[model samples]
Target chain A: MVKINGKEHEAAGKTIAQLVLDGGYKPERVAVELNLDIVPKAKYNDTVVKDGDSVEIVGFVGGG
Target chain B: MIPSKEEMFAALAERHGTDMQKKLSEASVAVCGLGGLGSNISIALARAGVGRLHIIDFDKVDISNLNRQQYFPDQLGIPKTEALEQTLSRIAPYCHITADTVKLTPDNIPSMLKDEKFICEAFDKADQKAMLVNTVLETYPDKYIVAGSGMAGTFSANLIHTRRVAGRFYLCGDEVNGVAEGEGLFASRVLVCAAHQAHMIIRLISGETEC
Candidate 1:
């Protein structure tokens, strides 16, 4: 099991895409970085998140 | 110590030590817009011993500005730049202050910001803010500007965030919550945003934080 945003989740070898979909957020609207490196958009489907991994997601909001 | 700029420097040297006092004497900053956030930022900068300050604002103080602008009632009709210049002189008499009562536009942004190391984008309108940012990005890539947005109405203090989006440019205030056109302003949100801007300015000036 792993924690996503502080909530415990069962790790089933979930890809980044699947995790984003489960979290109800649009992947295009947010940028994800694992271990301080940005994960390219094209690699979202291929990249996998292991247990106890930390990910930071920053979303774009409209601002002047 | 005798009572003068030299004497003040001597007194500050005794308090903060000579090296810190010398750094304070070498700092120079420019603040745009003399309204709410700008007013608070200018006061804080002056108090913090920033050696030189350039304040620019074209708007005149109005009755509505009394609530949160930090100007006295008698200064209602004076231009904001002039009012701030007078206020800062009384607050930090030894610091050098320059006031420009002119509006900033694309045509004059370069010359206006040439001498300023740090600029506070305190403009009230979104168009002006965008213009300043775009102009700085295009013309003067080296200059740093701290900008603010969504500082209106009653919102919790937790909503404000100070973030750096690029080199030498930090955006403060509530980006998610925007103030609608013609909406009335509140003191709490304005002060909160102003404090964030001032804090970032101090951090950048003191070398405690980098863009």
Candidate 2:
């Protein structure tokens, strides 16, 4: 089980990028934080999800 | 004749406790927007005796800004950075203010705000706020980010809060209200969140863990 934005989900043996896309967030639109560190945009696919891993996906909003 | 700095900050120093006054006199915080949240938050911070403020914005003060932003009728059509400078200077003559006119992007936000340990993200847009938060947290883990969200409608004042969203991020707002509600941004509610951010900065500056 992996935690996405603090919610538990089954994502074992999946790359961070794949899980992110499956979660309905576009690769280009959201920032991905795996565990405690950010997974740079270029390295999203290489980073895989494991049990107990935490992921935070935050999208950008229009600025004032 | 040049007036002494001590005399300029006399009353301000008296208002702040001795220890907090010393720290406030030496602390600097970056305000990332100059609209409703930025304008109000900047004024609150300046009046609170924060030693220095670096305010950045590229938009001019439109007539619409008068509704919720902190500015007088005479400030319409002037750049927000310039307008805010005028207001802050009057609030605290000794408070150092650097007003920069530039469009802040994710790539450049970190550079422009790199020097400040405490950062206030007061953008009207959620994307800009999120980008700034992610970039700053990733690059400068040591710094603190005071961000706002969802302070749009004239809702219950009790809904507004300063929540520690992350280890170094204190988000102040109702968190879901926006222009979509059709109520629009009101000054009183907006200031509630802005003051929350300002107070959080003061708390962090005075070496407190709670906000």
- Runs with alpha carbons beyond 4 Å of true place in candidate 1: A1-64, B1-3, B10-18, B181-183
What are the candidates' individual DockQ scores? Answer: 0.07, 0.34
- lDDT per residue as tens, model 2, A1-64: 9988789998878997898788776455456677757677667888888999988775533323
Give the number of the best model, judged by lDDT. 2
**What does the lDDT read for residue A19 in candidate 2?**
82
Chain A TM-score of each model, in the order shown?
0.74, 0.87
List, residue by residue over B93-181, the lDDT tens digit for candidate 1. 88899899999987898899899888898877665665666566556657777888777766688888798754565778776455444
Clashes of each: 0, 8
For every candidate in turn, the CA RMSD to the true structure comes to 7.6, 2.8
Q: Positional deviation of B119 in candidate 2, in angstroms?
A: 0.9
Docking class of 2: acceptable
Question: Judged by lDDT against the true structure, how good is candidate 1?
Answer: 0.75
